[model samples]
Target: MVFVVFIVAAIITFAAATKLSTYADALSRLSGLGSLLIGTFLLAVATALPEVTTTVTAVFLDNPDMAVGNILGSNHFNLLILAVFDIIYRKRKMLAHIYKQQRYTALFGVFMTLVIALAIFMRLDIPILTIGIDALIIVALYLLSLWIIQRTPVPEQEKNHSSQEEEYSLKHALMGFIIMAIIIFISGTALTLSGDQIALITGLGSSFVGSFLIAGSTSLPEVVTVLTAMRLNNENLAAASIYGSNLFNMLLLVVCDLIYRGPILQSISLSHAVTAIFLLINSSLVCYAMFARKNRRFYTWPSLVMILFYILTMVWLYYSS
Candidate 1:
């Protein structure tokens, strides 16, 4: 029964994700919000709906580790997706072309990593007030990002693309967006329940299951969007979606803490700590790659380095925890 539920949940999740992506793309066009902004804030949050819902549910049931593990595990899996994207889009080197906007996106990622790391290492008690404060900060950052983007002039080539694309009808897109959101919510709830059941049956602990299996399951939307975008030669959107998702995941930690209604920092398990550290390292490397002068274009070496680093991190996490 548990396995059956898992399969059902997976199917629902995949279908909803595809629909959500379509809605998000359409909405971005209608809103006149550049793909970078939409990808980073709007679409990223929509795609992370599963993680948000699952973690909140886990915390409500007093399974804090599951909540922490889901986010950390999701982060690790997200990096793996990057490697996959590189392999699938071998000729284009998607990361290189998107590095221009990625600079800010990567910085936001660094900020998020730092916040999570501090919460983990310092063992800070995140009170409701702190969560509220973090939420406000996220809102402010999002608004600031928009203002910056609005002020920054688009290049002639980018402007041409923007102008040439067919304008999306707001009413139609909104209807699709609403329907997709409902599906996402329902599927996310079912997936969370299935994940809980699997953890109980396997006796592997909910933290492990949530961090690895459940986290990977929820990140499928991101993987699909990136791979499909790459195939379509939408390199910019692909990169935007990947990095955007990371930023969204980071911010969701604050939301999770708020929903958990306690000091989430103190509730995190040791395994979660390991995952957080790995995320920090991964984000750092990405930041370095973006800023590095020579080899600005993502070469084979950095990609290989990232893959090896990811493997080692996972191995260490498995052994240490």
Candidate 2:
């Protein structure tokens, strides 16, 4: 029964997510908002909203580790999606086509991840008001990343999308996108509950469920959105969606911290820091892909290494937990 609910909720959420990329593209065209900004901020907020809901719920349930695990685990999974992009467009690397702003976004991910890892070890999450001081720092950095991304210049081709013949008027696109986003949020909540129940019945530990199963459940929308964007040949939107979602998930930790009574980071098992390490490693791999600009005939070492490390990290986390 739990599995059944998981499948139904996932299908519903993913179906809406598929259209999410389309509506987002239409919104970009009709409104002339660059795909970079739309994907990074707008589409990003849409896809990552589920994490906000689920993480806070986890904290309220006295599962702060699960909440942290979901954020860091989703961060790793989002980067894994980036590696998939590399394989999808192998002849010409995925990084080759995207705007330079992505490097900044990727760097922001790395910096934030480092903060998370260090916070766990240092226990710097001193309670300031309701939230921790560390959480406050993360919130501030996320805002700065947004401001910088907003100011970055988009390519003329992306800027000129408004000139193309459009299917959705700005009004219709806005309505459709809002409606789909609401569906995603509702179904995603269902998915999270069902997934948690399944994990319980199967006796998968909370950390495992949070890092692997629950994180995957929450990321289903991102998967569908990125795949649809690929089919549309919208590389910029596709890449930005993953990077943007990654960034949003990091910021989400601050929210989770706020909801918990104590410092959320200090309360969770240090096992979660294992997940954070994988995030830092994988995010650095992404930056390397962007900065190195090396392309092979079929695949690159960084992409391959990312997948390998991800699998290894999951196994390590399982045993450690």
Candidate 3:
């Protein structure tokens, strides 16, 4: 029964997520929002809706480990999606043409992940009027990231998407995006509950299950969105989505802290720091790949290395847990 619920949730989430990318693209074009900004802010938020829902649900369920793990694990998974992008993008080096705007976004992810690692290790007892200092810092940084991404100059081609031919109107696109988001919210909630139950049934730590299974499930939207963006030949959007999703994933810690009964960061297992480390490394790899401008036969060396590291990290986390 638990397995059935999980599979069903995954299917529904994927179906909704496929629609999510399409409407998000339409919204970008109709609104005249550059793919960089839309991919980072709007599309990133839309694709990350599942993570937001799942994290909040985990917190309300009193599963801090699951909440934290899901976000960090999803962060890693988002970057892993890039590796897939590189393989499929056979024309040119995938990361070579990624917009310069994403440089700041990637760096911001590193900064936020570092903050999370610090919070986990420090576990500060100090709270400002009931809110942990770390939570406040994370929220502040996330807002700053948003500002930076918004202000960055978008290339002319990206800015002129509004002039391009699109299939949906602004109103219809908004409506479709909202409907898909609602479906994702419902499916993600179901995934969270079943994931929690599965953790218990398997006698595995929430950190393990949340980091691997739950994280992968919640990240379905991102994977679909990234692939869809690539198919459209908007590699910048695909790249930005991954970077922006990582930033959004970190921001979700604030949401988790707010809904959780206690200091969410302090309550999470230190094992999650391992996951954070992987996220930081993968995010940094993105920066390196973008600047290195190297291309390979199938995929770049960084892509392969990052994927290997992720698999190894998952293996280690599984046995360690």
Candidate 4:
């Protein structure tokens, strides 16, 4: 019965998220916003609504480890999106170019992952008014990262949206984005709740379930969004949406910390450090891939390593959990 509910909720979430991607692309065309900004702020947050809903709900249910696992797991899962794209489009000239902002965004992701890992390892958390200072730093760093990315100038060649479709009103696009976001939020809640119940029934442990299962469930929208952006030749949109959501997932720690009634980072299993370490490694590899001249060859070695590493990390975590 729980499996049935998971399937239904996943379908609804995926369907809404697919529509959400289209609306986000429409906004990119109609708003005159830079593609990265639109992808990072709008589409990234839209796709991240599941993490927001799932993580917060986990904390509300007094499952801090589950909440934290969802964020860390989602960040790593988001990085894996880049690997999947690289493999699928390999040997094609598509997505052969790299953007400076993407490199910066990925670098920021690496740094943020490092911070979380170190915080988890050291556990020297000081709480101010029940909120950990580490949480504050994570949120502050995320905001700074956003500011830097926003100021980074867009390449003139990538600025124009060249679709020949009939004009889409910004009003209609905004409405669709909002409606889809709401549906995704509600359905995501169901997805996570079912995932939690499944974790209980299957005895997989919330660490495994939240990080692997629920995290993957919530990230389904990103798969659709990235595919649509690549289909449109908007590589920046795809890349930004992936790395941007990773950064947002890091910020989710603070949300969990605020809701969990304690220093959320210190309360979770140290096993999450496994996730943090792996996340740092994956993000760093992505950063290297963005700058490596080999990236121009259209056959990416780093992506291959990343794909394998993601699988290895998940296997390692499942057993450890």
User: Taking the tens digit of each residue's C-alpha lDDT, what string does model 1 give over 231-307?
Assistant: 55566666677777776666666767667756676776766766777777777776675566256554655556667
| Steric clash pairs (candidate 3) | none
Task: Note the Cα lDDT for every prediction shown.
Answer: 0.69, 0.81, 0.83, 0.82
What tens digits encode model 4's per-residue C-alpha lDDT throughout 187-297? Answer: 888988888899899998889888999999899889888888788677778888998899888888877777777788888898898888888888888877777745455
Off by over 4 Å in 2: 294-299
Residue pairs with clashing backbones, model 1: none
Clash totals for all candidate models: 0, 0, 0, 0
Q: Where does candidate 3 stray beyond 4 Å? A: 294-299
Candidate 1's displacement at residue 18, Å, is 2.5
Off by over 4 Å in 1: 126-155, 163-168, 293-298, 316-321
TM-score of 4: 0.94
Q: After superposition, how far is residue 204 of candidate 2 from its true place, in Å?
A: 1.4
lDDT of each residue in 54-100, candidate 3, tens digit only: 89988888989999999989988888888867856735677877877
RMSD of 3: 1.9
